[model samples]
Each structure stands twice: as structure tokens, then as C-alpha cells.
Target: MNTAGEHMISEIVGYISELVPIHVDKTKTELSSIMTKYHVTKVENEDVHPDLTEKIQLFLSSKRLEGLAERTLDGYAMELRIFADHVKKKADNITSADIRVFLGNFPNLKMSTVGKKLFALKSFFGWLAGEELIKRDPTAKLKPPKTEKRLPKALTIEELELLRESCKTVRERAFIEVFYATGCRLSEIQKLNVSDINFQSMSCKVIGKGNKEREVYLSFKALFHLKKYLQSRNDDCEALFVTQRKPYRRLTGRGIQREVKNISRNCGLEDKVHVHVLRHTFATLTLNQGADIVAIQEILGHSDPSTTQRYARITEERKREQHKKYLVL
Candidate 1:
């Protein structure tokens, strides 16, 4: 083989070794033999331009224009960059087998991580196909890895009371109460403006994922605590939740997580506590009190009923356990 062809074969062997967990020498020898048999001249397609990164940027731009959340756009960019790095080929030149190998290489990744990566790649390739950038979609037949269906962890009423008791400041108390009462996602609560709350109606509008707005009702106790917290704040910032210090800024998701973690530690709860747990507690408690699943779905701003159905699963499991323990049979 010519020097250029030999160089291409070596590069192909190295890439295959990275993807397959095989020894470099063995992969090189095997690939060299296969190349010799097939008269392979090049690894990457000669006609394909090296513009995968540029194409990805364009795709992300389209997503931004479509009003995708910045976080979601960031995820797509990161995942696609990882895929491009692994495959080391032009977007249009990537094959289904190559995509499968790239994903399979990350055997240690969480199922959710794998699923997110697959979704990004599938979307990218589907877009490319739609735009006639590629002859076929590489991810058309690809399936995301199945994630385990673990039930949402929710704090019991007694544990919640303990958490409330652990809070020495109004801010912490009000934050926990709002989480339990509204069942809002951490991002939703953090993005809340002070003007969003309607004290008379005891409800607040939360901007949820995809910038969808929904009303989350506040309990009487929650309303009282929120009023107290707001009264204590001296900042002119419009954010409902803000840092306690001077020059107060809106609380971030991480800030709320830290607050919840500290409160859980102070309360001495055994299980790990976080904002989502409080949201789960709200849903489970509401369902146990006979709230309709459809109503819960709407309040939670769930675009799909199946996502809301998980709370119903938790309620059903509790009923089964109670039956087993209390029945005289």
C-alpha cells in the first residue's frame, strides 16, 4: 500500500481499538489484513468534509431558535461533541454500526446518561436526514438503553415535621414549605418572581420546563411562612427567593439543594434529602389525600400523564404494604 493509504489504515486501527477495547497491536494486524483483502484505500470518506463540529453548532443554533432551554441546548452540544470525538468522522460519514460501537464503549455510564447521549445523536442525525445532509439516518433504528424505574423518594409527614423544626430561620422554613406545598421543580422555584405569588388566592404561577407556565397552589401554612420570609427580606430584587446577605441575588438550583441538604442533616434524617424529595413528598401526600391523578398532572406541569403516573404507583405500593400488614387474613 502507498504511504497515505498505510497512514489511513493505522488511524482506522487506532480508532477501532479505542471503540472495541482491543489491544492496539491486535487491532492493527486484523484491520491491516482486512484492508489488504478488500483493497481499502481510505478510512474516512474522501468526499465528506470535516465540518461535524460546525454542523453541530448550527444544529444547536436551530435548537436555540426553537426556544429550547439553555440547559437542554448545552446538554445536546456536550453529548454531540463527545460522540464526534469518539467516532472521529464527519457527521454524514458516520454509520449505524459506528454509532452503536461509540455508545457501547461507555458501558460504565448510567442508563440515563446513555439515554441522553442517544437522544442527542438521534436528534442530530434525524435533522441531518431531514435536511438531506446525509443519505440515511444512522440512529434511525437505534434504541436508548432502558433506565431503571426507581420510585421517587419522598419524606414522610413526620420526617417533614422534623425538617421544619430543624429550620431556625424563616428563609429555610419557607423554602421547605413551598417545596412541599407547590411540588415545583427546583428550577421552577428558583425562577419564581415575587410578583408571581397571589397571596389572596394562595397560589403562584411557576415557569416550568420548556417555559410552560402553570399554577401551583400554596397551603395556608405555606402561605403564612412565605409571607413571613418575604417580610424579613430587605432586598428590592423581584425574585421570590434570594440570598440572605446584602446585594441579594436570586437563589440557584444548587443553592436550594445545599439548603435542603443542610436542613436534612440538621434534622438527622437517615435517607438523603433534596429538593426533588420534597416535591415527591408533596405529590405522594396529595395523592394519598385523594387528589385526582389528572389534577396532580396539571399542577405538576407534566406534558405527559405517564410521568405523573409514577406517583400513583407509589400510592398503590403503600396500599399493598398496608394491606399485608393490617389484614387479619
Candidate 2:
């Protein structure tokens, strides 16, 4: 064999040695057999690129500084990690083709989920280009996979009453009312402090996405239940909601979701409802009852008017359904 062939074989052996848990000598016989069956060519100008993991960390740090919520940061990190693992290439070496293959690898994922992964990649590469970390953004020309626009599913008034009746405790009752009344995100509600509420004003301030603070009003029924729940608790935990047992702690987002799902099951509702469903319900019902789209947008802390317009679209659909069902000549 020529010097170039020997050099390529030695590089392959070294690479395999790094991957195997056992010693290199033990695998050499099997490695030799595989090496003899294939020829290797060394590519020129195979430049070393910056580490993918390090670049991802920098991207996440930049996002954190921009006030993205921890959950959102976590999601971005996960998607990027998946990309790094699949491509096994450094940040600068990643190409649009690599991204396309990475996305196509998950054949079972929905288009919506694939779109989200694509979005994360786009954002990361866009940042790298802006910071001069990469000469070009790989995702600049890639289009996200098309996804269907499904209408938001909001509970009917009768279903809402049924869910209210299914509450097994004052805390549950308060949670249902407050969630619907404020239309707060699950994280926003979980982070609420007891001091954030003002009984006299019938409102409370919540820290929302991007750490932005917003005031949301409580309905009379919500206030009545919330005040009752607070009064009923003996523990001095400062959170607006607490676990029902001793050594009381602030209710976590998962805990809140579990409670809501339990209530949903108890009511025999067809839809498996969670906090986000309640948020949609709140927006849909409010829009149906004559609330302005822009007003709901502000209340929901939506930066874009188009996001709020979804609920308006839901209301319009419902109006058409009602007209078809009940309107008579």
C-alpha cells in the first residue's frame, strides 16, 4: 500500500479507538478486516471548525440575555442538541443539506414539531451569521414544513359549568376560576406570588414570557374563590397557590396541570383539557362576548396582533356554525 493509504488507515484506526470502550489492540483484528475492504481518500483543506456545543451555549446565553423564559431556552437547547448529535459536524461545517437530513430523520414527528425544530435552527444560524461566527447561515434559504391551521378548541358554556362543578376542593375551584379569568399561561400562573394580588382592586400582576409584567383582572366569582382558598390555607407560603399538604410548597406548573387534567377527567369532558386549553377558552369566550381583538392581545401579552386574531377567527367560525344551526328563514 502507498504512504497515503497507510496514513488514511492509521487515521481511521485512531477514530475508531476513540469510540470503542475497549482497548484499541483488542479491536484491531476486526478493524483490519473492515479497513482492507474499503479505500479511503483524504480531502484537502479539511479545515477545523469551532465546536458545535460551545456555539450552542453562546446562542442560548444570548437568548437568555434577551429575556427569553427558561422553558423556551430549554426547548431551543434540546432542538440544537438533536441537530448536533445527528450531523456530528462542527458549527461552521453544518450545511443546509445537513439540516434537511436532520429534519427528515425524524419520520414520525408531526409537521408542526418538525417546523419548530426548523425554527430553532433558523434562529441559531441567523445569530451565528450576525455575529460573524459563520460566513453564511445554512438555514437562510430553507422553508419550514407546511403545517395545517387548526381552529382553537374552546369549551362551551355548558361544559365550562360542568368542569366548575367537578372541582373537589376550594383550591381546585379557585384554580379553575383564576385560570379562565386571567387567561394566564401555566408558567405565569405558577410563578404568581401571594403579594401580587390586590383584593380591593380585584386584579393581580403576573410575570409573563420574556419576564414582562402585566396586570390581569379577576372576575367576581374568581375573586370569591381565590380569597376563600387563601383564607382556608394555614401555611405561610408566599405563593398564590400551594400544595394541599404539610411542608407546603408553591404549586409547580406540572402540579397545576395534573390538577386541571383530573378535573377534566372527573367532568367526563371529551377533550383532555389543560391550562393552555383554558387560556384558549378564555380568549375564545371573551372574543365571542364582544371583546376587542387588540384588547385581548394586550391582556394576553401577545406582541403581535395576528396572534390575537386567531381567537377572532374562532369566534367567526362559531358564529357561522350558529347561523347554520339556528338561523331560520
Candidate 3:
């Protein structure tokens, strides 16, 4: 059965189930009978149009040349594969209406998830049109759904202190301090090498999205703990952070994340804390201390100024709250 037909059947079944409380097993049996009588067979093996696959390959190759990250390329490939499997149409024959219908099928997904899908499609179709692979862009008129601009959540000074006190190991203490000081993303920190640190300059080089390298500063406190952790290590691993056991290896991103969750749990914090929360705390605290937005952007390795501006907004709200609490008038 085609997607549309399957969707229609699902809707009818849902309506019947809601209007009359039938036994769930009986409902499934009856639905199966209906499907069998109608000779409705799922068309899962239809060959995707060669033009579509060819254009997707060309688009991904161009994006690779343009310095897109491998993870980003994989996401594009996954989204495009789903679209191609659904439409099974040539790149040139795909219409905006078809795109709309495709998007409509994902009614239960979050706006952010749907928006990501739309972005991938738009990028693929836009690339095809730009390269003259397709005469017209099917997604030219499509717009992403607006996502809410929530302030980045930062840890309070008290919460930071609590987390610090919760650390049971030198490595854990060092991990928290470095993440809080540098504001590097999880991947950046995971990929960090001991050689990347320049103790003389109190800074380290980190490769951010799109493999762009930038320098992030370490605080005196972070340097103290990091040095202590390194001194405590007996392994020969070059990774800045490594597993505690013998035969130690570079800590994976998930390993770092698991450590963060453990610290959060140990701290008895009400909110779920992650690596990005440490990043937000760094940005919020630094900006509150009068760091320049542009400078913070460079330190955080943000390609877009607007992405760093969210931290500015957070400081503004904090300032207003401080004023309210302190005003004597």
C-alpha cells in the first residue's frame, strides 16, 4: 500500500476505535481481513528513480567539497533517502506539492524535527537547481517552521559549587573545570589531545563544526585541576581525557556524557545537566562578567554572531532580575 492509503486506513481505524470500544485484538483481526480482501499490498520494493539518487550523490559530493561535516552529510543522506523512497520520482519531476504532502505525513513529529527534514530537502533541491541538475527547485517556496527562541539554560553559581563538591576523582574535577572554562562542544572536548593545550598561553586549539579551528582559554582553576589530573595519570595515552582503568584509551563523546550525568546525579541537582549546560554556564558567566560578544563568539567558535547573541539576551534578563532584587527605591 502507498503511504497515503496506509495513512487513510490508520485514520479510519483510529476513528472506529475511538467511537466504539472494541476489543483491541478483534479490531486488529478485522483490519487484517479488510486489508486481505482489498488485495492491499505494501509497495516497499519500488525502485527509486535513478535521477534522484544520482542528484543526491552529486549534491553530497558538492557539500563535501564545501566542507560539510561527515555527521551532517550522513544526516542529509538519511533524510534524502527517506524522501526518495517515498516519492520515487525523478529529480526534475518532483513538485512543490509533492514536497508539501511529504512533510504533511509527519504530523506527529516535533516542529524542530520537521524543520530539520525540510532544511535537508531544501538544501538538496537548492543544490540541484544551482548545479542545473534540476530545472526547478521543488522546495524553493517552502519555509521552515518557526522554532521557539528559548534562552540557553545556565547553571547558578551555587549549583556550580555543588557540582564541584560532588567530584570524587581528580579527572572528574578536571573534566568539569575544563568544560566550564573553555565552553567547547562535546565533540571538541572528546577529540582534544594533550598536544592541543598551550600551557604558556593558557589556551588550547579546538576543531569546531565544519572542521574550523579556534583557540579557547582556560582559567587558572581549570589549569590547576587539569595539571593535577595529568600528573595523576600513569598511562601513555595522548588524549587529554582518558578512561580511568589500565589500557586506558581516549574517552568517547558518550563516555564524557555519561560522566557528566553521573556528576549531575551526585550533585543532587533538580534539573538534568549535560555537557552543553556547562557550555551555557561558561557563556552566561563570562558575558555577565563583561566579555565582548564578538570575543565570546571567537572563543566558542560560533560561525554565526546570532548564535552567540542568545547568551547576550540571557545576561540582559539576569541584569534585570538583579536590579529588581537590589533596588532600594
- Using TM-score as the measure, the top candidate is 2
In model 3, where do residues sit more than 4 Å from their true spots? Answer: 1-45, 314-329
- After superposition on all CA atoms, what RMSD does each candidate show versus the true structure? 10.0, 9.4, 12.7
lDDT of model number 2: 0.86
Q: Tell me how far the alpha carbon of residue 116 in candidate 1 is from the true structure, in angstroms, after superposition.
A: 1.9
How does candidate 3 score on lDDT? 0.88
lDDT of 2 by residue, 19-82 (tens): 8765666565566666676675543334323377789999999999999999999999999887
Task: Estimate TM-scores for all models.
Answer: 0.80, 0.82, 0.81
lDDT preference between candidates 1 and 3, better one: 3
| lDDT string, candidate 3, 1-329, tens digits | 45545565776778888998877666655676676556443434588877788888999998999888888999999999999988988899999999999999998998899999999999998888888888989898998998886889999889999999999999999999999999999999999999899999999999889889898999999999999999999988999999978789999889998998898899787365888999999998888877899999999998899999888754567788878989999
Q: Any runs in candidate 1 off by more than 4 Å, and if so which?
A: 1-50, 314-329
What is the C-alpha local distance difference test score of each model? 0.85, 0.86, 0.88
Better of 1 and 3 by TM-score: 3
Candidate 3, clashing residue pairs? 1-41, 1-42
